[model samples]
Target: MAGVAAIGAADLVAGFGLAGALVLPAEDPESVLAAWRSLPPDTAVIVLSDAAAEVLRAEPAVRAPDAPLTVVLP
Candidate 1:
């Protein structure tokens, strides 16, 4: 399985998939959650765009104590 995943703006993450990162160019919370839920279980890192990070502010799944490392882009 892949080691990294990304979810956020299309323009920012659209090309990340080329590098083998699981990229989901999503903007809404629903899409964001869907992206997260669909990631390969072995994914280790997750990068979120500013907007996508905000959408997940109150979300526990992605913020779980044992969840993958998450980085929020500025």
Candidate 2:
């Protein structure tokens, strides 16, 4: 997990093919959104936060059919 966060580090192993960034206090939706936008066009945005997923669902960024958005609800 090179760029993975520390909190939810173990949750994304299967999705990322390795450990993923852990969700920390400093890494809120805004920060995660920025990172999501920075990813390549083909990159996927997998949301592990149920609340965050609901919020993102209302955003235009997540409306497209193939917008590379995934919501993993708890």
TM-scores of the candidates are: 0.86, 0.49
Superposition-based RMSD of candidate 2 using all C-alpha atoms, in angstroms: 6.1
lDDT, candidate 2, residue 11? 45
Query: Can you give the lDDT of residue 72 in candidate 2?
Result: 62
Over 4 Å off, model 2: 1-26, 44-47
| Candidate 2 lDDT over residue span 1-74, tens digit each | 12332212234323443445334321356754554455555455554455445445567876777776465645
Error of 2 at 59 (Å): 1.5
The number of clashing residue pairs in model 2 is 4
lDDT, candidate 1, equals 0.86
| Candidate 2 backbone collisions, by pair | 4-20, 4-21, 5-21, 5-22
